[model samples]
Target chain A: MRTIAFAVALALAAGLPAAAFAQDEGPSTAEVDAVIEAAFPGLDEEWAARLAPDETMEQCNASANVPSDAVFEEIRARAAGTIVYPDDGVLVGSWENGEKLAQSGYGMRFSDYPPRRENGGNCYACHQLTPQEVSYGTLGPSLMGYGKLRDYSEEAVKAAYEKVYNPHMAFPCSMMPRFGTNGVLTIDQIKDIVALLMDPASPVNR
Target chain B: MQKLMTRKISTVALAGALAAGLALAAAAPPAGAQTDEETQRGLERFRQMLREDPWANPALLDADRGELLWTTAAGPKNATLEDCDLGLGPGVVDGAFAQLPRYFEDAGRVMDVETRILWCMQELQGVDVAAYVKRPHPSGGQPVKDVGAIATWVANRSEGEPFAPVLDDAAGRATVAMGEALFNRRSGPFDFSCATCHSASGQRIRLQELPHLSQPEEAQVAIAEWPAYRVSSTHVMTMQHRMYDCYWQMRMPQLEMGSEASVALIAYLVDKAAGGEIAAPGIKR
Candidate 1:
């Protein structure tokens, strides 16, 4: 309790003085380097490298999550580089299974080590995918009538797939997890999630 | 952290014990021989079971947290919040929660519990409530601690209390009207409204039942409960948080936390659930 109190006091002290905490010629790359390096101390070599802000994260962080169009394009291009299209050109999967994938919010936690349970897209966590879902979190836009509005066009289906694959490809610094790139969900799972958003028969449309 | 852990352990144990007890009490055979009194007792036991595991009974937990958060205090004032009136007299946390979104003459404006808490935090503790809302929880990557706790504590106080928001007052009525409009106004990539899930009864997305918030019983259950403990997120989320989150899911800009829209929504829901019992400090799955 005392330690927490002390930390809070220190935070208050550092935070209360506006001028002291104000930006001074912006954060130096070294400062950014230090913060990023310290953030991942014990991870494996590959994971540790991920701690280093890619060009996208760096620009996003530098601009405080608001990037100019050029910067946004750059981030999108870099993120787009990570995309690996499926061997079969088809992006849409079984909407029935897709609905299940979108609804289930399991996997990705450290406890799911050895990857026992399959990863779920958990799309409903941040969006109201279906009007009837009561358990969803409200972070992203509701996906109800997604197919109805878009006419389930091939372009829209492709866009949804890309958005789910790496949200930064669509909107830079998007809070949505890069389900495909992060290995959190498989390509097939991404297809299912896409189907959930675009399938006419899916509850998302109903 | 130890204290938090201990509290969690005890709460889980208490819930387990209560669930086992209720199961035993409610386990009478489904037979024609059972008397009315026995049946009533069995039903009471089942309700108790529902109470112990509130997440299973979503309505109970929401109001339960609201009641609990009503009394606890954690501003720089270092004082218990028992005296901060909710339209009603000091420490009167009963029907006050339900009747709120009503005009408070002292505050001279209509406010719901979340906004009300923001008011108290500002007035009593000198905390910059707005700043707190703008920044994510002070402990990033960790659970939000104080604000949610305070919110839940206050909410828990009026569990079983009836909802009676003062709709006659100009401001109160205006808030309700605005909330009603917002409930149906859909503006997102998908363009969904609250009506999509809760406007009708008997709607189930999958396994979960979407309660009709328009009905008094359903409304009462929802408005009276909240600031619920969500098992998936493992965070005790406040109603304001819930509302903003809902907006996010709708793919809309986050509601300015504790803004008019948020409070008005609360008023509308609470008004809908006028006569239901208040239950606070609800546990959820």
Candidate 2:
């Protein structure tokens, strides 16, 4: 019995039972929802609504972050439908302004309520574009020399713009956030981030 | 907003703390591959410092205050929490934490130590303590909530014992199942579940190492030391605060204190840590 218990412990530590137990004896969506509702009492309705998983999230959750090919395609399509491009045809903005946005990790938190200033992209939290900043996370790829690598083409700039706005459009179930679709970043903010990535003169390319 | 500590915590002192913390990393082996030579050596030196002098650490201040909080009569009921039971029978704190996250008959659910404390506060003191639920987490050397301090003291009781939560019955099974699903469920604007950063072993974000909570061995070591005093924030953070902080980072709404979902998640994580040694009031960075 002790050996069996040890084996179970070992399996859990190695993440071997992740798939099998993910499907077994799990609570239904409704049951989970009930628990969530009971979990947060003081949250305003606007904030509480975020706790509920939409169709996209529901599919993603059911599959354990790796949906089937059909579901993956559907998620991309559904997420794509939510994208709202900038009113003007311009895809890139000032890299200088974008640099500041990239460094900040403000907004979206409950503490930032009542609106103090413009929201930040918090880009540096996950990616390292500039060599000067030693403290940066490796959750996302380093886009250093981004424009230089792509030959600074117009099409590459457009792709960069879209990628910043909605990372899921390019890679489904990607660790990157849906900045544009979730309204975490404005069209202007995203355009500026694109400039940071696509402008050869920008630090990312330098 | 960043609280400007007038005296910027010196880089040299923080470096020393980091070296000490690295000692803890090597003392416990990871459940998966984590072959980093530099970290291992640093961890060895760090443990040496702890062995030299455990009393110099500051977390003991919180534990000191917590001991007083346990016996003192306060709240609306004008009563102390000393009579409260922690599943080792009424008023029996000895080895109670080691066997917690168990099914409580009165509550009809599985609850971890933090949730049990909240229950005792409400029942024995009539404190209406729910008013402070979901308040912003204290940081940057700010004062922590009472829950953090009390948890530190309670967890200190089983400092060396292995976890042994009771989970043989149906209610225990049901709560753990709910928590397991909750941990994996993707929701909110970010589409992030707890598994996004933690399910995988040997992964990290920036300098911080991420443990895979899905595995029992890893879960046992990681979760066993909550109500930890973080060097970066300089606050003793309880498990409830950790849940709140994670949800906030995902841009999800606040997790209500002592809520079923919170308790359920704790139940799942604590059960995963079974057989690991307890080392509460743990110092963190």
Candidate 2 per-residue lDDT over residues A1-206, each given as its tens digit = 99989988888898553534554456767788899888867677788878888787777677776889998998888867777877887888989889889888788777778768888887777677877655566667788888899999989987787777777667767766778888888899888888888887898887
lDDT of 2 by residue, B69-97 (tens): 88899889999999988898888887898
Q: How high is the lDDT of residue A104 in model 2?
A: 81
Interface DockQ per candidate: 0.02, 0.32
Give the clashing residue pairs of candidate 2, or none.
A12-B215, A12-B216, B22-B43, B23-B43, B220-B273
Q: What is the C-alpha lDDT of each candidate?
A: 0.64, 0.77
Candidate 1 lDDT over A1-206, as tens digits, reads: 99988976897776453322443222345543443344224556644444354566557655545789889888889879888778988988888898788767666443345677787877775677776665565556767899889999999998898898888888887756677776767898888888888888888888
DockQ class, candidate 2: acceptable
In model 1 chain A, the worst 10-residue window by lDDT is A17-26
Candidate 2 chain B lowest-lDDT run of ten: B1-10
For each candidate, give the interface RMSD after superposing the true interface residues on Cα: 15.1, 3.4
Model 1 residue runs over 4 Å out of place are: A1-206, B1-12, B15-83, B135-144
